[model samples]
Target: MSNFKRASLIFLLAFLALPLAGFGCKQGDLEALRQLKEPVVLQWWGVFDDTDSLKDIIASYRALHPNVAIEYRKLRFEEYEQALLKGWAEGKGPDILFIHNTWVGAYEPRLTPLPPALTLPQLIDPQKGVEKSAAEFRETRTLTAQDIKNNFVPPVRDDVVRNNAVYGLPLSVDTVVLFYNRQLLDQAKLTSPPATWSEVKDAVKALTIQNTDGALLQSGINLGGSANNNRAPDLLSLLMLQTGTTMVNPEGRATFNERLSLDGQAFSPGADALRFYTDFARPTKEVYTWNADLPEAQELFAAGRLGLFLGYAYQLPYLRAQGPKVDIGVAPVPHLNTDATDAGRKQVNFANYWIAAVAKQAENPAVAWDFVLFATRPEQATAYLDRVKRPPALRSLIPRYQNDPDLAPFTAQLFTAQTWYRGKQPAGMDAAFRAMIDAAVDGTRTPEDAVGFGAEQVNQTL
Candidate 1:
């Protein structure tokens, strides 16, 4: 349709939807709808999801408010950011968008914080004798900061809340889990996956296969450097967190390069984590099964050459499709050993997921935010999680998936799962980490020096 016709039709829609599911609304609710007297169209964009996954929820929401119409578009993740940037520059960006949880701070300037209250449709007054009767709605203060903290996991509050206001909300959360080949473990005489990093080291010895010439015939695990493994950053960060390394200080500066007192001795856990990780790739170390010469971690794991692969829950379907014949089993990501030598340490894991947020460009931000609340609430979110086969972020929904073979490990870890790196330069931060991993694995610099240098690089982005 031409621009003029579109504009005229929208004008008519605004007037026709005057009831807007508020025919029996109170005075205040009617006042709230004054600005919304115009047609409210919400354009939502997301990545790695299909329209069918959301069609039912959208239909349910639309059925409540005839005045509001939501149009959802799924974009390729690789091209999503550039598309958003370009469209935003032209004032044509989506009013609603799905962004990685870590991107909250970077994308905050373009987002609108949730309002204190929302005037929403509560019910539709349908009378068989009075066919013209419209729907009814009420104002609600159910989307408070405290409400978010109570309803969702701790990491959701950590990532989505700014100074005091909430900038976004999530429907699901995923954590890194140990994906191991059952056949490989049985061959190595191991009956179960490792429960601690120390066990992982010993298991690597039995699972590794090498010839007298010192050439690797098959690898035990995928770890060490970041060159070919896309998950290298998450794995390394997870290790750092588990070792009690503070990723960023209160001032938002990188502090993973600093030191702390361990057993009355001053040492840098960050550096220790880095050295421990690089040991797997060094020929001199006992856990020397991985090196730069090996194929990408995902590739090696799929071919059954790799014994254990640390990955997020979202990757399970892809791994299954890639290695259809590979018998895969999942276990909780190994934690710091809770033995006599290491006691009272916290259980830490890595979180990687996307969130739903409203744009500042939204013509009616209240309406946009209302949809966000409706979509993330328990009922709608549960339906979404059911369709997606991922872990739910809501505490109430955890039990439903507690026994699910593929989802249990991820859901169980949500209590302590965390994330760092909230800056705008996600790509630059990845490059700095890759460089740090290379220096330590290549013996070009000490692990401590490399970590310090990487921290400085990340500071520039802040």
Candidate 2:
């Protein structure tokens, strides 16, 4: 063969050999090997005691981005604040962290401000099912703002924005509900749950049972451990809000100390709300109940001893599992008579949100943001709600689940639900409120005194 012909044959053979070599190669093997050479490591600190579901989510993310490795550290809710603060001060904090919605005000300075480039009209449009008010407030034009907004519910969107900037995205939304024992109601000859606080008081009076020996057989409602538990500050806060009392000033300062005026009369409504809660446990009223050492509050409700409970929507699954025969029904928490907005509507449920944020000191903020954006996408959020059995945050998800009989009340409350921040000192303020409630319930101080003192304590922190 001529030299040119020989060269052409060689070229053809080389091309054929290339295809043959590729035929034996695994799909994406080359790309996968290349990705393995330079993996990005992300440290994620999460305040989720329930890790199984979070692990599954992380695994899913990893499957999508094999080149990125996520290291997750779970922290208890009570200890997370201190732990995260310490980690941040030491510059050893995770690349991503979970923050409670109310905590954004406290942690905003410590977090990185999302770039303006990410806050574009397309990404920040409220019409896209994000809270228009919040988007306008947060100016959320950052890299994945649209994706994050779309993933979250309107309330979550509202919670993450502060001073016209978006600080984080919510992973979950929680609200309080009245979990009542049908057996207890039926035994008491009650046909329905209390529709108002006065009815709640009367029901509690009827529900209380004492043994012949005078030892308590069953208590009506357990507000908290000795009425001092800080688990439900928002419950009291809601009462204060519904009564037209602002819990905090615009600058995030505690305002519960202010003597609220109504109809030309000065009153401490916060104190009244607190007193009403504590008085239930007063022995004279025969409403005083709850033992910290015995069956937990939930257990009491499940066992048919407790008639009612103030718990979150997330508690439904556990309640159903633990109290299979207890026949339970959920309603919004009962409101004061003066709370027209809440009273005219279903019960008023307090809103709580769990948020996802990128640490200020993250080594790879962009990558961490990408993960946040992906996890908070509307579709992903809906999937998460399904997997976790928690309520969805996005407005669009409401229609999808509106027909759900179990979820209708909760979905309706999300629209007018409220939250409060006790300035930047959440822990201290929470403790003070708990102490105030405890004092009032134990008769050490009246509700008026307790609220005044508690407000002072909270204000001092501001």
Candidate 3:
């Protein structure tokens, strides 16, 4: 071959390889990022909230980055997981999605952990008498794991942060609080709500009214039995935690039924908690108030036949809709006051909420996570919380909502809210918890035996 022809072929090969070599280093180059500055669209999918609820937050983000477009879609809670699975399997899932806190462990593999910081270009200064941007500059914002821990509530750290990486962040966190009948308490001559388990027992005994033939005329507190009780697992979890049970260990093993107390007591707190929970359903117990034959707890409470029911923020609307004139009052969950000085005996409410996360397979993961970070900021989060009227997850905003009469009880519990690890199959673990309570309540097994059985079953799921 001629020398000139050979040289021409080599030049052609070099030209093709130039772009391939540049690809490896382009990600860190600001000029390369600025070159690909076309509008990028993101699809966001969520559950239990309509797009209108997030419209203001979305607009706030858009004002920061005009070139980014977000399309928000709301999915039904019952059908959300299957739809997400199908979409992801087909390589067409959302760039951002809402994940329940309990399911974070199961969904971690599909979610993109936020980076240490984000760098994006934004308009810096507008010309005088002009509404258009005159200058643009890159802005860098950083969020460390410590920042998340310091800014958000305790359970958010426990649920969202894994291995020093944040899996997601929530706009709000809801906790289970006591909902009691005002007229029933007034009828019983009790003006104040119960503040401790012993007080609850006393109140229940006073409020419960049984007819001559042993039929329950008015139930005390709708607890103990699993089937009819609302949020029975969460209630039981709160009991276990307050009684000094570690629901799961760092290794993701179910150790709730077998742990010693924080003071190193040689007793199973889970067993004790379970017994305390199921006592109200036992016929022989003085605290007996509910049974398996009773109607659903919410229905009974709404109909004004029940005294107290434990529920979260979401249950308020349902209860109001069911019986507007029921005259209900909300309070913090009662604690175990066996030792007043023992901080561990304080009230521990259950934290449950949805967190927004970026999909690992997202075309622009950085931008997706950036949007999430932007939305969860204090201002944007406040707007979202105002629309939802749920509990605030941020520590700074808790005090502001504390003065709100309707939200005070929930907001007060946010600092102390806790949740147990339910593993990959959270629903199945909760079912085991319910079964444990039911078995103990029915006298099929002793509390100790039931707790051990439930722990063993929950460990399998983990």
Candidate 4:
């Protein structure tokens, strides 16, 4: 059986045991489920999560809409895109899908916008042994664009709404955070993780240990290189954003590589960020620590040899499992400007998460969307988050995690998080970034030239 085909019976039973009172058992729920006679099945395709994470929500939703049956399938990330594309091309695909926030533009044409309201039959549940009744229907209001802004954080509204149409909804939002080894920090006599990039530079100088032939005996942090570092693109992109680089202009062209006006002077914020990122790989730089010769960053950190590593909430599981004895400490990613007193000061972070969207090919788009709406409610969403130990996407749930040590760091950064438009070709844009970083690190091109070339390449995709 394929990875998507296999479902663990144990996981299903555990979730089935969870109480559905708060999730769905409202006063009129039984009447609706019993009266409906339509038999509808919604196929939900996801990449990261399995049925275990959603089984309870599915059960709860069924309790309210007995006519609707949900079948969830989880595919390997590598195979997910091809499968979705192939299915759509064949005129068959899942009614519901999980897409990355960046994929919204590229995949917009293939999605159906959430409807203003869903009109359903009063007696549609085939299990209730009743036929569809004529002229008796009920209307359900779906979320409006304004409701999205009022509910989720700022970035959620920015990503899901385009052309005044809401295309997707997210169960949770995740941000990049700094992951470090606590034992290494204690040995260095540093009391806490670095709060500012300036502190990061100082800590790197102190933690890095070099051998006689200038080989790295122990590395300080993971920065300044690509290809080997899986998250190098995100790191570089976040740095450019923090430096006030406008990644894409109002005309929707790739301008990160070009110079922009800053305080009545022409400056290249993207090039500056590139130079700063590649410096750590240069042997002559005072803050040198990382190099292309080093192993993959997370691996080094997992083995407890690297002092600091930049990562996301999803990467925590592997780190903990691999380095069971490693004391892992997470902190908010460092900021460019440390002045909290400045009224104009703003802290920027990067966003990377998935959004639930309805495919244009869905046979029952309205019913499919209604399930999506019910599953994202606070009560249902909180259960999923609590089970998975992840952060929240809704503003109302932020305070619930304020005192949580593991999730607080990520939750604190969601409000000001930002994501840039990747035009209609996010993959092409991503490739350009990797090539630019490589050219600068390998000395094949100056930071300015590399960024300019990258912008030119990205423009072709736009």
Candidate 5:
């Protein structure tokens, strides 16, 4: 029999022998089975920065179940997608896996549907919420309906739930925040960071400085970051969210070119957002800040050369490590417009989540699920968040982090956090979007043309 069949048989035999042991079996009989000198190694693949933390988790798990062993592998973010696809095709992949929130939709069919016994509702009550002093989000013991109702925040919950079923547990949450150099604002005579996009634009213009030779002395904002494969797409996604244009329709289809038209003219929000982004590099714009060969945008911001950058909460650790001397302040990504009416929906921010799922070919689904539950439980979740200094996905942890001076603004924006998804063709959609942006930036295509082309490419892929 195959490995899977053998594992299934072992579990079945264990269950069948339970009553027999109670009737007549001795302690040594059970001990002999438990101590069976056979290796039962499970494979796990994930993206994690700290290997020691993962090892600690694995060690803790192994302590609880001494019979089972795990071989853990870490894949870099950039390499994970292709690696996973190749592994899946060969039916030789990790038994458990970590997938990005946006990837769930594409990979759902490939993953095992968490057993009904593990349903969230059976695990926790939705109305009651998790019972904790601060209403901390905790992982449910089972994937029951109650677990779904109580633990997960909406929209985020929506991402992992397909066809009214939960497939994975959220691991870490991230949202975009503004990182500004205090000295730069002070040098420009600014009293505080901008609250609205218009204010931000004005501030950028004021802070940007150049010598007579036209070489930039300092830039107000580092508009193009290599992280996230350059910030143009992320910036556009944020803009689309702000403009109240859902890039995908309710049917989960691309709507960029179809639904978003400004004043009867076909407006490519994607192109417009890109143009606005690259405009910062123009000599007359607020900042001329792009070089083929330069340190990363975050590094420039940390080095005090750039006044502002869009970064996630995780970047704080790196900033502290790389440039402790720079006076840095965090704020919400500036709103398109700040008004009382916009209170509930002012700025558009992007939120990202990491999800853990069981592979369809997993030899021990029950065991994998149990470990996932233990790792994502409230106490453990909080511990991971504390280690990474990232915001938690649980609703209750929001207030605790909100009180944090550095983390408050970011946590506050979680309510308005919008996510991006490329449906079944993420790579294709991303490529098309990037091509359109490049065309618009290079002046080869107008914003309208770029958006139209992007829509066509996306539609073709769909």
Candidate 6:
């Protein structure tokens, strides 16, 4: 029999015991059968990080269920998805898997909903001086859609929930923040980083220096140009969100180009946001500093010549290692304004992280989900966060890590962090964003037309 058939039969027989035990059969008989049940081992595939990072957490799960073992394998990012799809097609996929938040829509068909709850046989007493037998215990526990919304950051709900079903859980979440050079700010006589786009414009003017040939000697910020710019799509998306541009509409169509009227004022937020972003690369604009000829943003930031670069927590260690002499500091991404009078203005950030999911091909879906829930629990999640050093996804743990030096900025923005569904072709959607920027910069299309064209292209992917 296939693994699925065998697993189905096993679960069916286990349920059959429930009715028998309910009909006056001795409970000890069921307990004995549970104790004699064969052990279950699960294969887990991951990306970006190694297995050693999770070895200790896996060991902790094994302590509770001595019969369960988890084998973890980390794959290269360039090859992960293709390998996973091929493996699943051959019926040899891992039991538990890690997938990108943006890829959830594409993988929904191959994923299994988390079991509501599960019962397991465990040892309760230990100090009896004699060996004690384990007993079957009922665990009436499940994470509901509401529980997910209440327990995690806001974007998590939109990313993991589908058709009112909880599909996955995230251990950590990352948000883009302003990575600035402390020394550069001091040189410009600025006491602190800019908190608004206008202030950033003024600061860039004061900080950007020019050479005799009109070439940039030191740039104020990294923005515009998609090929060499690091995370250009994320930065542009952040601006669109801050300007209240709904990238995707209720019908799953890309409608970011739609114009709006506010109090008799008409404007296209997406177009305005695109103009605000591309102006930095325009020589005619006051905020002009960077251009297509500049080095990569990350490299420029590490070289201590760039004033600001937008990045996530995952790059902290790398930035520090790459530039030991550079004095760097992190701050929340700038907002339009911090004034309370304009309460309609919302503060939004970009969210990027992986989620833990149960594969449909798993022979032991219930057991795999049990381990997932355990790993995300407060006690266990702390270990994973400490090792990974990413922002905590759980709401309760946010306060504890809010003061962390590397995590503070990201945690501060967790409540406001948001993401958009990029359809099944997320890469293509990102490419469309780049193409839109290119069209605007080349003057081939106005900002309004550029955004409309981009949305139309993305709609095709949807």
RMSD of each: 9.6, 10.6, 6.1, 13.8, 10.1, 8.0
TM, every model: 0.88, 0.79, 0.86, 0.87, 0.79, 0.89
Worst 10 residues of 6 by lDDT: 126-135
Tens-digit per-residue lDDT, 119-231, candidate 5: 21111232442231111123344666456646765546667777777778875678877888898999999998887767777888888776797766677776632232345
* Residue-wise C-alpha lDDT for candidate 4, range 168-225, written one tens digit per residue: 9999989999999999888888888888888889989888989999998778889888
Expressed as tens digits, the lDDT of each residue in 278-344 for candidate 2 is: 6765667656555444366777676777888877777778788888888888876677663534533
The residue pairs that clash in candidate 4, if any, are 36-124, 36-125, 37-123, 37-124, 37-125, 37-126, 38-124, 38-125
Best by TM-score: 6
Error at 286, model 5, angstroms:
5.3
Cα lDDT over the full model 3: 0.85
Expressed as tens digits, the lDDT of each residue in 305-338 for candidate 3 is 9998888887787888998889989988777774
Supply the TM-score for candidate 2: 0.79
Cα lDDT tens digits for candidate 1, 60-169: 88776666899999999899999999988999899999999878878999999998887654333433212344334567784667878899988888888888899988
lDDT of each: 0.84, 0.69, 0.85, 0.86, 0.69, 0.86
Worst 10 residues of 3 by lDDT: 126-135
Cα TM-score of candidate 5: 0.79
Worst 10 residues of 1 by lDDT: 126-135
Query: Model 6, stretches more than 4 Å misplaced?
Result: 1-37, 119-132, 137-139, 340-343
lDDT string for model 6 (1-462, tens) is 999999999999999999877755547635634653557889999997688778878999977677788999999988999999999988888999999888888888899987667765555452331135444455757898889999999999999998888788988999999889999999999889988887789889878988998798889988867888968988899889888888888989998999999999999999999999999888888888988888888888888888988899988888888988899999988888854111156677889999999999999887889889988998888998999888999999999899999899999989989999988788888899999998887789999999999999999888
Give the Å error, residue 389, model 6: 1.6
Position 273, candidate 5: lDDT? 62
